[model samples]
Target: MPALDLKGCLDDSPKFRKRIAVYEDSIQHFEFSLKTLTKLTRLQVDSSTEYSQRQQELATDFTSFAQSQDDPIIAHALEKFGKSMIEVEKCRTMFVSRMGQAAYNPDVKPVIQNSHVTETFISPLEKFVKETLFPIKELKKRFEKASDEVDSVLSRYMGKKPKDPTILETAKELADARKGFYQVYMEYVSKLNDIEAKKKVDYMENVLAYMYTKSAFHHQSYEILKDLEPYMRDLTGLLNDTRQRHDEETSESSEYQDLCAQSAVDIYNPLNAVSSSTVSSPGITVPYHNTTENPNKSGYLFERKGGRVMQSWIRKYFSIEGEYLVCSMRNTKTSKDDDQSASYNLRVCSIKLSDSYDRRFCFELISPQRIIVLQAENEKDMHEWVNSLRMVNQKALNSDKAPPPLPSLHRRGVSDVTPVIKLNGFSGSSGTVSDSDKELLKMVREKPGNDKCADCQAREPEWASTNLGVIVCIDCSGIHRSLGVHVSKVRSVVLDKWETESIEVMLELGNTIGNSIFEEHVPSDMETFRINPNSSPIERDLWITEKYVKRSFVAHKDDKAQETVNQTFWDAITEGNLAEGLRYLARGANVDYRNPNEHLQTPLHRSVQLGNEVSVEFLLQWSSNVNEIDENGWTNLHYAANSNNVRLVLGLLKRHAKADIKDESGKTSLDLAVEHQNVQAVTALRLFAFDKQHNSSPANSLDFGFREAMSSFKQNYSFERSHGTSHSALDLRQTKSHSPKESSSLHETGSKLLRSDSSQ
Candidate 1:
């Protein structure tokens, strides 16, 4: 079937709805049929087992009847026949075993052994239905909602009279709604097409596998029966020999009886004797079983906690990863709490057995934020968990980079502290940093211009706009938050958990680089037009709105030709001059333009190939598609991994680059990374996959730590901000205006400084 079109979806075409309904019906039918097939296949395997057992029973009965035969010759023949029947029964039993392995054994290894019907075939069908098919229904609902919103906005836009004061605002809203609709429409169609294509190939592949398994079962049965033929032929001779031996054995019966009695005594002696250590006693100390090669421990534990009023215990899966204690909900599907997972820094917590609780086998983990009460399976488990925590905590304390003690909650406001972020847990309170957070803070603060606020040039900015890639003071952060999360996603530099991708953006574009793009055309009278750290809240708010919201100061060259603008963007990025490149983007350069002169590579591809992360970050902020392919159908991720640049690979993945996209060689980014032995890159990709499988929040993805090499790039660009010319907030309010000549001179000099510094 042809894929649904976005235009049809956005227009809400009747034909589109009809086609979608038909597709939905087909999907339902396919699901029903596949589930039925799985159920019947399992039944068939069970039935075959029963048939083999029945045959074995008949063979045993025949052997008993043969032993009661009257004549020796006839008895030998009958006995030989019974023995062959038993051999045939064994062959039948082998058939059942092969059939089960071929049909539905999950334990069968898909790599080293042939793919089984369940793990390789049926499981993918189920996953595709769950992960792909079901999500399409939700996307359709959102698309319809967006489509209706566009209609409503468009109706208002068209109904307005000419020269209405609200016309511009209405037009902007209409445009935004239309843009939202288009995005949802495209996503819906993409998912619909994906599921449609998957069902076709998946069903055929699964059925082909099922047929192959059946063929293998029959082939193996033939081979096994063929091998049994020699055993059947030898049965007649075996029966004759057995009759002759029986006659001789009758004479040695007394000797056999004596040997049996002595053998029984020998077997009983070991059974009767027992080591003193093996005996159970209240005073005895038993050694706990240690199965792991490493110190890390993971298992289920019941934690005591309560809702708003009533207290109860909830089972959770807990594990020690590095120097942190991580816990996740035991039943993810039924979990009602939004906190599905959580991790605590072992360096800031102490673990000990607790008798204060009524529950037995309980321990308490005391931290600055809250105390967690956990119950283990038994006495041994409780001891092991406590000992493990102690060991990890001691290791952290002995390490050179252990985190400092968390601050007391009672001494400060809750807003000043980091809120507890649950990874996949039921209950938690926020405080303390995992060791990774410290390194993250150090790396981000070390960025150019990061020591001060992007706005007003305030010292030691403690907040950041994750989307805009700029740090700001607490005052500017309040203004950023007012702009709404869509425009500027404000996050704490100290008190909040930062996602890996957000940090990548921070590392690439700090205050200096961000200001160069956003404030490229700031008025020359900086004291009059701009605000400082001590500026009034009103002035700060107005300046921020004009700079970020209205984007009035961003340099634009409307007169430049489209081709010239794009060429300048390409050139500026190649030269690592992001400010100039961003200026060209403002002039209407295509961020995703595929230049034929460079093997049809987009700016993103070129940046990754050149190992310039700043350009890549700029393109991403501009909303360039990370999955866009070059002339060879290779994404920027492919280029990064192929070049063995793990940072670029990680950065791309953080920006939501599709890891499964294959190049012309049918190799994914992971495949290329493996080929190059990029261990870190491979680990990053695998972790991304794990996050998806567990439905984890992207904020918790493993951070591929910052690289020292990026500092060299920053040095080459000379991005050090000039903070010497700061005007005091007092001086700014006193000076109403300055000479036009003085303003022009200062602006010209600052521009020259920026250009010259960038050149170096």
Candidate 2:
């Protein structure tokens, strides 16, 4: 299937629209039914040991009586009806569930989402449930009811009771019940026979109808697709071209529909083979075996033989039948039937190399009933048999992981962007930070009291939480990390990585930003939350959580001088009032001013996110806390990283913006870059880290051309933005480069960054 041409389906014909609506309704129904089935499966069946044991006992007694040729007529009927009904019930459940999954395969689900082809896919399933399972289920129930009555009488008369519990009245009642059960059983069996006899014919007819209906589903669209694909090999080509064109140029042209409809007239009629059906004899044979063979199953074959017991060390034939590894004393030939043929269920059986024996052909098979020592004729045969058994075991256990679909498919949301978004800029490149980034960092570092721990007010706080954006002492950082990444995303100021976007967040909400919310409602009588260097682990945790999480001493937002200072600072940053912001800094005002708003963003944080170079430079020059965090535990770098402004990223990296600072979710600025697929940002961050480690800068770094191009790209982007010019993504991708090696190297670096991230 050439991936149902999604773009071609732009045609809003009445036929297509009708189909789309029907498809949606069917999908809803399927989803609801799936959820209901899942819930049903979760029900605690056979919950208690006594209940399960009783069921087992009933089944065993019934089987034994049914198989015994000498059993009473009523007993035989009870056993036969009971076993048949149970098997049918199990079959119905499994078949329905498996069929539902096939009918609702998620891979093909999107096709239905855009079409009205619901009846084509779903009608056969509905028919099967109605004609096959429903009728079988009804008959099975009647058979079970009759069997239960027979069982009741048998239990009363001669079951596991210690004494003769059968009185004259009870015996008489049992006889009447037995006769009544026989009558019901016969009627139920007669109906069941009728159903079984006609089931295949009815089922095949329904299936044939479904196939014929679906074979022509979207036939018109397929014809259009066929015309579109003479040169195009895979759907990927057409899809990519269509998507790229759609994105590159905003066109609402009806050319696709017009072309499709116009092309239909010139198409010559191709010879069509007349539809016909043929029936062949499906021979049925009785599945009779000498108690050991699995008649219906033939699985992965290993022809060689291995002995069952060490005493019988002569090699014997073994074959897999479903989940069983059946061993026979003789070759698996029709003429020679082994009397001691044994079958071990691979589901519960474990095979391993024999510890006591040195022979290469010897291995041990441990089952629930016995430990069998098997000896193969040769080492190669032994290895193959062992491998075959283990392979069967794996099929039963489902432990292989090479091509799992869950993890790969689940990564489609926030982290779904291309890993290297180097080409597109915020009108800025992904990386190659700017003067704006540098200024934002400087401003945050200069913010008053922002450098110290929010709780302790300890000088030179070395650690911070990206989400809370509050700097903390090392002791408190440890306590914060212990709270789990959710409660406190702690990172080292100097040592950690930082994304440009998170750095911006830190600038937005630093000390002044955090304190107002945490301390707004503080009572004078309450003890301060600050901790000393000597504070114990418990003391640090209590104070940290209480300060950041609990807000134990928080006060109501008071209308005071502090509020005016905060509001003025935020207003200056928001409005790009560099002069006014300077005055506040001159008057000993808080540099990292937090807004009283719910976001609690600081000046530099908001400015970087806004890509305001002037405000960032002014704040940075004023010596604000660059390493400070905002309420969301993000720094200025984080904000810069998320933006298209490569200049903002450059500014922070030049100022040594911590690239490793985790946000509220424990994701670093680099992680955010990767998540957003800011390829340029990722490259710049990694390059900066590499340069920093090697004591190199953009001008001096030996990895020359690409880094220079990135720097140049950032400058050009800033210039364009300043001049009120916007470059399209395609134009950005067309930027002049010195060599293919530059991009290849960047790609390699990005691949390494991803691998490093996984290791972290």
Best by TM-score: 1
List where candidate 2 sits over 4 angstroms from the true fold.
Answer: 1-560, 696-710, 716-760
Per-residue lDDT over 1-760 for candidate 2, one digit per residue giving the tens place of the 0 to 100 score: 0112233233425564354445435434544563454344334221322233344456556666655434233343445344433332222222222222222222332111211112332444455455544564566576568668877887777653455555666778788877776665555444444444444456456446445433432332233233223112222333465578887555434544444445432121112111111112122111111122223333222222344363324445566766766655544454443335567777778988664764445788888887777765444445556776777776777844342221121224322231121222122222223456657666766777677777766677766666555677644555665566645566545433344655765665676666665655565555554467655344666776776556564542343476686677678767876545533443335878776583767888888888887567657644556667878998899898877466778776666678888889998787877676665567678767776677443333333334455655555545545664323232334554333554445544555665565567
Predict model 1's lDDT versus the native.
Answer: 0.64
Which runs in model 1 stand beyond 4 Å of their true positions? Answer: 1-452, 457-460, 466-469, 482-489, 497-513, 523-529, 532-539, 557-559, 579-589, 613-618, 644-651, 662-760
For each candidate in turn, the TM-score is 0.34, 0.25
- Candidate 1: Cα lDDT at 468: 68
Q: Best by lDDT, which number?
A: 1
Quote the positional error of residue 226 for candidate 1 in Å. 69
lDDT per prediction? Answer: 0.64, 0.53
